[model samples]
Target: MANKFIIRWITLCIVLVVASIKPIEADSDRFNACFESCNEKCKNDDYGNAYCEVKCDFDCGAKEVSAKFNIAI
Candidate 1:
């Protein structure tokens, strides 16, 4: 009985992992697009890569929030 319970738990974990991967795969294109936009804008920055990355994140977050509220950032 203990072995059967362990097997079921393992099976459930495996199924959950398989189910979760598909949505992340589907979102890869959008992720890549956002990364590319950040990369381009950050490339010419005077503060260098690290600072630009932080700035890009802030900019993206602000854009998303403003867009969510139907306002332009």
Candidate 2:
């Protein structure tokens, strides 16, 4: 439990740093859709907050790429 707590905080710090450097367009509809969808799925699947956050970021990023290049992700 202690180890997980430490790891979770570490991951959160790293994410925060990256986010600060290249912030997500939180107001965009597509991003909101992707993030909310991912977060809901993760939550329904009983994922931890750290896992959900990372998964959502990845899913939203993929969506952005697909939309940008018109490629099927």
Candidate 3:
């Protein structure tokens, strides 16, 4: 009984660790995609509505990337 309980506890800890890591990985991927897309848009058009859209996308992506890595900027 004690051995079974110990095994369960270890399994739970491993699962928690993995769950936490998964989100960081996913957020990083999202940030990278957003950044790349925003850069492309900005490069294609550098003024007016296109500029605003690109800036917003870049800011949001940077925020997500910083948050995911616990970076301050």
Candidate 4:
């Protein structure tokens, strides 16, 4: 019974770890995409302030993505 409990606990830990890693990877991808898109848009517009504002909005989304991924950004 003790061995069974230990095995169950280890299995649970492994499952949790795997689940957590996936979201972090996904959020990193999302943040990178948003950063790239915002930079591209800013380059095209030639409007510094508007570019900054749009970039800020994208940054906010990136922040949320970090939170969802359990990361600090």
By lDDT: ranked, best first: 2, 3, 4, 1
User: RMSD to native for every prediction?
Assistant: 6.0, 14.4, 8.4, 8.3
Backbone clashes per model, in order?
0, 0, 0, 0
Best by TM-score: 2
Model 2 misplacement above 4 A: 1-27
Q: Candidate 1: how many backbone clashes?
A: 0
lDDT of 2 by residue, 1-73 (tens): 9999999999999998988895434447888888988899999999998999998998898878777768996
Q: In terms of lDDT, which candidate is stronger, 2 or 4?
A: 2
The TM-score, computed over Cα atoms with residue i paired to residue i, of candidate 4 is 0.35
lDDT of 3 by residue, 1-73 (tens): 9999999999999999988784334465676677777667667675566675668576966788687678998
> Model 1 off-target regions past 4 Å?
1-32
Off by over 4 Å in 4: 1-26, 48-73
Error of 3 at 15 (Å): 24
Which wins on lDDT, candidate 1 or candidate 2? Answer: 2
- What's the lDDT of the predicted structure labeled candidate 3? 0.74
**Each candidate's lDDT (Cα)?**
0.70, 0.86, 0.74, 0.73
Error of 1 at 1 (Å): 49
Q: Top lDDT: which candidate number?
A: 2
Model 3 TM-score is 0.37
> Better model by lDDT, 1 or 3?
3
Per-residue CA lDDT of model 1 for 1-73, tens digit only, reads 9999999999999999998785312344554567668867788665688777777767666665565578965
